[model samples]
Target: MIVITAPTGNIGRHLLPLLLEPVPDGETFRVVVRDPARLSDAVRDRVEVVTGSHGDPGTVDRAFEGADAVFWLVPPDSSLTPMDAYCGFTRPAAKALATHGVGHVVGLSALGRGTPVAGRAGLVTASLAMDDLIAETGVAYRAVACPSFFENVLEEADSIRENGVFTDSVAADRKAPLVAVADIAGVAAGLLLDRSWSGTADVPVLGPRDVSPNDLARIMTEQLGRPVRYEHQPTGEVFRTLVGHGLNEAFVQGIVDMKRAKDDGLDAGVTRTDETATPTSFEQWCTETLLPAVHG
Candidate 1:
């Protein structure tokens, strides 16, 4: 049995179908979510639904019972308690993993190590701490270290569609990797299904190549056939923009700090080698995901 948290999220939503495709016959798939209705009919039909927040001990205990491999992600809590979001949320579950004898845990995290900027990468710092906490449990773990996501561009759909303009917090030439949500899901699903791997590890899901915000603008312009422009929005503005979007102040600032960290090279860990390469390109993702989103 495999237990998935945040099943309706960016990566988890796409991951469900992929996991179902090669689900070695008779294996069980279960999900713990606060609102079961958010899940699609297809997912509801396939997995056992435990309708409750994963932060709640009762819900996690109930959902994880008898489960083997588990997919984990600490849903972004807008509350002031996000420092506790991963550790607090996973506390009981970590115990549950040991008590239930779960074999593997696949988690989502950011990629930034051995960099001075990483120290203040807000949510990322907390997430890395969470990874350590999970690893200490002695359960075999794979922390998928993701860079910026292609879906992040979708957040600027209105600007791109209406005015061929988008903004970010990084410099024009600061190149960093960007992974498609589908690829993150693919990595997690592959690990969850295969029980051969053990021990704690970090799987960096670097995209096909590094790209700057200007490079992204050019790609978007080419894909949309419009004169797209990229602008470096200040960190203060990034904080305001996210807050205006209804994110909690704390969460918004975490994002602001993350952007600052990125501009300082938090994700500059790729050398274009096949080993660091992921399958999707920014253009391919724009065509398949962003193009439709912006056009819509």
Candidate 2:
């Protein structure tokens, strides 16, 4: 059996269909979810549902039983500190994985694991630590290391529509690899289904090329058929803005630190090979995803 957590989330939602299109023979699917209602009737009818937070020991214990592989993705809790949000949430599942003897795990993680700033990159640091905790469980783990998602721009759809502008904490000219969530899900699904690989490794899912904030603006302008510009916001301002939205102060600060680390080239260490370079590009994503969001 293969288990999936956060089946309703961005990456998880995409990952689910890929796994279900034709599940391999002798391998059944299960999902640990908080709200079974969020699952479609089609999905609910197909997979075993263990209702509750996957972070809960009891939930994972039941879900992991008889499982051969697990797709692990931690949903960030804005009410908790970054450490608690990632590591603390994952601790129980780590224990359950070992106890259940689940052999393979595909997890969501950020880029910059081996970079100098990685140790100080707040939420990214915590996520890497979580990877370590899972690795200690002796599961054949694959942390799908990723940079910023092209879909992140959708968060600024309203701003783009109204003011023809989008904002970020990174510099306008600073280029870093950005991926589409669909590609991330595709990579994760591939790992979860293939059990031949053993030992822990990071499967980097960098997109076709590195893109800057300015490049994003250019793409948005061209794709949306309007003038769109990039606006750089200070990390501190981002922290305050998010905190004002009622998020935990520490969690907001972790976002700030992560942005700072990105600005400092935290994701620039990896070389994009044929395997690491995913198919989607910023322009393609802007046309396919962002354009619809701005105009729809």
Candidate 3:
């Protein structure tokens, strides 16, 4: 049996289907979610839905009962404090896995997580800490150190749709790896099912290529049938923009620092070929998935 945590998230939504298909004979799949009512009826019917928080020891124990492998992911949001809320949530599950003797674990982590910078605290640091905790459990672990998500672009969709322009703090030409959440989930599901590797493996899910905001604008223009353009927002200006959008000051500052890190080549590593050779190309993703999203 495979237990999937955060099964309602972007990656988890795609992952559940992949896991349910091509299963070996009688192996069952289970999903751990806080609220069972939130899961789609089809998903709830297809898999065993275990209701409880990932951080609760009793809940985790029950979810991992009879489970051979697990897929783990932390919810992304500004409300979670880096060390307290984020790492605290993962630590309990990691400890539970160790006690229950689960065979494998797949974690959804981020790129440039091992590095420490002043501004980009919390999520990055907390994820790395979770990776370490999973490793200590002695279970075969694969940490999907994914790049910036392509889905994040949706946040600027309204601006592009309205003014034919998208804005960000990073330079127009600053290239960074971006990966689809589906790709990350696919790899995680594969790892959970295979169970061939041991110890901790860092799998970087790089999108087909490195791209800039300018490239994104061009792609949007072609797909939307409009003259979309990229505008570079100043670092100072980002805080106000995020605040106007209703984000807290800490969260807004963290994003600005993350963009600054991107500009300095913090997330510029090319790991698609090294980690998962079957990487998804930007054009393929844009044509098949992103284009439909814009048009629909």
Candidate 1 stretches with Cα past 4 Å from truth are 243-247, 270-272
Candidate 2 C-alpha lDDT tens digits along 1-296: 99999999999899999999987888799999899999999899999999999999999999999999999999989999999999999999999999999999999998998899998898999999999999999999999999998888889999999999899999899999999999999999898888899999999999999989998888888888999999999988898899999999999889989999999999998999999999988888887888888888
List the candidate 3 regions with Cα displacement exceeding 4 Å. 113-122, 243-248, 271-278
Candidate 2: the clashing residue pairs are none
Q: Which window of ten consecutive residues has the lowest lDDT sum in model 2?
A: 282-291
Residue-by-residue lDDT tens digits, candidate 3, 154-245: 77667766787777778898877888888888888778778889878788877777889888888777777779899988988977876788
C-alpha RMSD values across all candidates: 1.7, 0.8, 2.4
Kindly provide the TM-score of model 2 when superposed on the true structure, using C-alpha atoms: 0.99
Identify the superior model by lDDT, candidate 1 or candidate 3.
1
lDDT of 1 by residue, 75-194 (tens): 877765456766777788888887778889999988985577777988787788888888888899999998989898888899988888898889998888998999899888888888
Ranking by TM-score: 2, 1, 3
lDDT for model 2 comes to 0.93
Q: By lDDT, is 2 or 3 better? A: 2
Residue pairs of candidate 1 with colliding backbone atoms: none
Distance (Å) between predicted and true CA of 176, model 1? 0.5
Backbone clash total, candidate 2: 0
What residue pairs clash in candidate 3, if any at all? none
